[model samples]
Target chain A: MSNLERIAKLSGFSKATVSRVLNHSPHVSQETRATILQIMKELDYVPNRNAISLSTGQTLQIGMITSSINEIMLPFLNGFVEVAEQHGFQTIIYTTNDDTSKERQAFEDLRQKRVDALVIISCVTSAKEVESYCKYGPIVSWQRMDNPAIGSVAMDQFKGYTLALDHLIPKGHTRIANALGRTYSINTRSRQQAYEQAMQKYNLPVLRQFYYPSTYTILDGERVMRAMLQQSEALPSAILCSNDHVAAGVLCEARRQHLRVPGDLAIVGFDDTELSHTLGITTIRNPIAAQAQNAFHLLSGPLRGIDMPQAELCFELIERTTT
Target chain B: MSNLERIAKLSGFSKATVSRVLNHSPHVSQETRATILQIMKELDYVPNRNAISLSTGQTLQIGMITSSINEIMLPFLNGFVEVAEQHGFQTIIYTTNDDTSKERQAFEDLRQKRVDALVIISCVTSAKEVESYCKYGPIVSWQRMDNPAIGSVAMDQFKGYTLALDHLIPKGHTRIANALGRTYSINTRSRQQAYEQAMQKYNLPVLRQFYYPSTYTILDGERVMRAMLQQSEALPSAILCSNDHVAAGVLCEARRQHLRVPGDLAIVGFDDTELSHTLGITTIRNPIAAQAQNAFHLLSGPLRGIDMPQAELCFELIERTTT
Candidate 1:
């Protein structure tokens, strides 16, 4: 006989009562529940997950959607896995490649597969598309989201940029340049706003040619630096980059051009990545691990009725050899 | 009634016949199958994965075990996801952190969950532990494994080291030093063998003091370089590093000490990571993507019953300004 049947027989109770005890339903009496639990332990009985899921109408699986499983997103994913495992839920990962159609398909597929919840990292979907899914189950965004239907766990990008700019402006950098990432990215927009405000506050000249729109890559940083170096006009005393990966590229290109860092030009970058430690690059340290942890908490904890949790992680400005 | 019931009623057939048709079972007749398929499309009936899994006793999931999900391992994981998705299988990642206990626990858990197969990116367990796990299911190792129980897919590390040394030795460097990774790493052993053989072939004196065993990090590389620079003895004309990240640090430290590349000291690194591309460092290019793809294929395909696929990916010597 199965463990459920044995528990029913030993306790002289119905299978439904045994199931109630196993599921911790409040309807069962405390005395009888304790007696049934004792019998279950004596028989070395283990509950069957298939039956439990069938009764509760829930699947014990969570979904994680990432733009791409590359270097830029590995640290976030590492934290996600660790937290998900502790919550006794297996994660089903879907890589959408930042394509809208693919993201929709992935969401539809995961929903069809009956995942209990979703944790989206860098969602590329529109507000309406995300809202339609929010009605179905718990959904948490690892990065900032435009839709209120999704709960977000992200760092304050505007603050991070302000810290970087504040560090540079106070260091006697009257003419400063900025290397911005893609305009479509929400984080980039926040950083761009901070750069603009900080420049205006410091009363520094903002050159149109100095502000470059590039992708979040070292090669893009190199291209922007090369463009700056080739200009016939006066060069900026310092440069502020979107992230450390791009900053590393700028440093490499500058060295290649036989320019001494902090001697020829001071530089600041966001995201104190491992490269920053090796290169001694001054940068803003975004709390990525903390953001990931908070995202996991929002995904795994009890669902709130209406208001979603919006937590902003702290940022730090690290001074190093670059600036 | 479910959508399957509607399709069966419309086709005037039993539910089993409809399910067989939907599952693409060989027992169905061609005419009836075609009619039922057309009816399914007309009715918009989708097969339930739970029912399919129950009928076929297949999970439709593959397990992946890796050392860590850092920048170095991101490309491999990306390639694995791309290939695994094509075969209609989801890849579940488990990180071992290069610990034997964690590796064993992950293997046992995956086995209990009944994953279709396993693909290990690096060795986290001893040969005996891996061999024991191989008894239950198909296990493929992306990194080289000496045991016959697991299939291996790895880049040609020995040849890569030889290529780097060949480029350097021909440049008239007699007193060459080596910056190796952790002594316990298999790749380190292979590269060290190649370096030793190359020095012997050229009849150059190999000094024990010239070799440094450090972890695979830029800071570790810098520390090793600083230690070497402080030594009273004469330094080697060139230094060969285990990986590009390490080589970048070596370059930074050399620059800090007022040394010149290809003038004061020539440098070469391995793996040709993104840092290598941005910095234009001379190194060996390993086929990381191809190796990942092959490992996924071995895990998801029919290679479980046969001996493991022991194939070596090709490597190339990329000449850059660093050398």
Candidate 2:
């Protein structure tokens, strides 16, 4: 009897179940999967990887390195996977939790696994940093670092930020604040530049006291709100949050303080996420699907050698009750 | 010059940078990585995988298949990855989106990749169906079905559902509704059965009309709430939502209709998510970290090669202002 028959005889499962176990089919109960796995371990049967790449080479697997799997990045991931797979490429995700070393490791790991390409989403890894390995295969990133080696498909970061400022400044609110996450992030820098320029244009004093840096979560927003309130500087009439979650936090905090949004303090949020609609917050919608599609076309292009363009998609400001 | 030196010279980067590019280090900038990659491609330098897998076999990589990367599952994933890496097992994730065929494909793919083991998370694959494949390698699942072949470390799912029902019925909620997600899912079935059993024990009729099957999102909760209110059947006093997101929807919808929570309609959510705390909706806390810890221990455990227990971790009912 083959390995399947031998395992079935010992485990009392049917031959088909043993076969299903070998094939990694879900049709087999978890119990059966375990029992068969135990038996396989006992038998010391290690299925190797050398042949699978050869067999499934046509699937054209692309490995995506993500910092963290969260709602904000899901659309980008979903779009990339959906579009890539539609064109016969499968996606394998490696979560590095934003660790530079782990990301570097993933770069090596994917290469060792013989993946056709690498599409990085939401990572701080610079193009120059990974330049050493980029020559081996196609690399695409959702971040824009002005890296020519990597095909870039990012939201028009600077323009997107100004759109928010443009909407807020004209409202006659000179006392404007912003929640800036990760002082080093390109997006944060872009938004910072826009905030300064817009405030300069409007001749509004830069209320640095109202600027909330390193805030990401709702609690951060709440804490920032509390901190800004305690500041020696005069209170700002408006606050621009980094994202909807933080905006929600500010709203909740404002509610706690009995301060009405727009009435007492106008607020704006980035990433018009699902919660933005339900929470009724003014936000900027990052064009995820378009960016993902553009990146996929460049990374998966048939040229195998082609000129990669800086594909910056559009963004829109959604005005809601908060502002 | 060797391939590395040749590429590095052409790209105007040091040999170390070229080696880093080939090695997939993050130290190289994206621009430099891209330039070197372009040079390598021009030189027809395709680094093969067979040798690298041979070199990196000591890394002890384990492949995990996830159904979907949503909020409820992230804790489990985080715990599992943290624990597995602690034990020196590197994880490679393959997302199948809960599609059975794709799950089976993951098994074969992982095996072909030559991973030491496979962990299946949140997939609805029955054990009996995939029994044959389990004989090939060690297979673990995050779900608890008690299939002899697979090792399951899951939340005490059935007991978890009853914990919610037990909390509600005693509060004198006879006219209770439930938001059931995926009628065929094991968790839904467990909750459905528990709902019936609890209602029967309370001597209350099973209000099937109040059961909103196939519900998942907050919008689904809103829709369910709308449907139930429109029904000629007497409106239920409270609703046990499938998850916190749905419960949030119900809460929002109730607010829309000017109905006070726990006054006109009591709401209880499962999977005490971050939103649960923010919204102050009472929810059951699924011990994801504990379950993940158990699953990791079992999957990473030296086969004791013996029988692995179906580790059922506990759940807690968190009561708040909503109830």
Candidate 3:
């Protein structure tokens, strides 16, 4: 017999009653519901939830919004999709070019389509821009500034910076430079503050010329490093980069200038991405996969009925030849 | 009156008729369609196609499948999404861990969901594995071995290698070490063939010890370079790397060993990825963004009877500091 017929026979109910129970109809009695459910359990029968939802006019679909597409965000997106798939939901991705207007439009579009939840990864958008949309559905953000109305999941940038600085300061490096990301970003600001604090704690002088603003790309890092090298000043003993991509750039520039990495300029980087392990660059590790996983859980779990959780992830300092 | 009602009144039809015309229903009469479309144009009505698609399942949606997620594929994915969006359709994404079983499962899942098209960006599966699924949708692949049953989009790896070798051979580097990717990859085999042909053209003896198989990551490049340094009886004048990521590794390891690039060991890389631009590594440039755009056009355009032109792109040679 077919699975559905077997389920009907085991439940000791008519096939019509079994079908109603499977569809979760309001017409079913409590005792009939219990009997049908017990039979389904005994027979290990699994219903096609999507088909049921379709007939009932309910869809458990979520939308994910991201700013531009590139390698830096792929891992996080992959992690989010994996978690989303496991929860029996499909994600509709909307990508904007880091434009605030485009981001707003994407939110409106997804909201109009009635996505059950939204996960945004736009670093440039302010909390106010996304506030109205949150009222329409459960909203969760990753690695951006916190919003009281929506859930947020981000790496502890300040702690990550401290870990990198802590590793460098003990190596007796007094003159240090930093290749940081854009000044406007929360992550960059946090790391910058941590860098300044670490410098003060180590009793080292902080120079304005030593801080370079980069766009988190390897080429940006290299360009900033080259500009710093051309200046009429002595090179720093070490350079602290905002991310692994930028650090790869700094390493390239240092090589071009014929400067030794650890011997001439001990370098440390953030985001201990997969590239870090391959390049042997000493870096501070931020659990990006864990961040994505937690964000998904906050937006889709049973506890979603409650307020979003504010939590910080642990980071580690990985030592390699760059330091 | 609402915009829909106004358009309906102007077109001498109900609001539903205007919507049906806006959605390009095959059932609508040509004269009635022209009248309704003209009314929509006169009213300057902009339809939310995504919302319409969500409500009515008429337009085609394509699914893009990838094995690994990284920076190299970001631009390509972005290009694909932009093209798909422009064609009044959506692109869904699925990522696998480069496992054959996982890849097969992803294909099956997408097929079961009835996506209109599939664009794969990894190793090519067996013809039999993809045959049954291809019957359900059009399948296009990128950066994999050419399969007769599926249309493919790929960079010219042999030409890319020839470009790199042409640049290096003229630079008087007779003894050149090579860092290549996995032997199983079709691109790797093509590049290896080019390397052999180039060596023969220059009458240079092939040094087996100087060749290393490394994955396309900076750390792998570094490890392979270190091993080459430790194992090779003689150092080559230059190194030809598989890609920029690996080239960055070799550059880093050479710096650690206190060997000067170009001075001690000149280098060349492939793909000319963003990392290559940052490091100023002389390499071959593949138009990944263009390839992605073409793939999207093929799946969502004429292949779907949409009004889009078909096109193909080519690769170029970019020279920088490593050579």
The local lDDT score (0 to 100) that residue B159 gets in candidate 2 is 88
As for candidate 3, its interface RMSD to one decimal place is 4.3
Model 1 lDDT tens row, B260-288? 98788888877888798887788888888
Residue pairs with clashing backbones, model 3? A71-B71, A278-B219, A279-B219
In the predicted model 1, the residue pairs found to clash are none
For candidate 2, lDDT tens digit of each residue in A164-280? 888988888888888997788787888888889888888988877677888877778788788877888767899988888788888878877888888889888888876777767
Model 2 ranges off by over 4 Å: A1-52, A55-59, A110-113, A302-312, B1-59, B85-90, B110-113, B302-312
Q: State the fraction of real interface contacts model 2 keeps.
A: 0.13
Of 1 and 2, the candidate ahead on lDDT is 1
lDDT of 2 by residue, B10-86 (tens): 88889877766554444678888888878876776755434434544433556677765565677777777776655
Query: What lDDT would each prediction earn against the true structure?
Result: 0.76, 0.74, 0.74
Interface RMSD of each: 4.2, 6.3, 4.3
* Each prediction's number of clashing residue pairs: 0, 54, 3
Q: Report, to 2 decimal places, the DockQ of model 3.
A: 0.28
Writing each residue's lDDT as its tens digit, candidate 3 over B168-270 gives 8888888888888767778888888888888997899787678787467777778877887787377888888887888877887787788888888888877
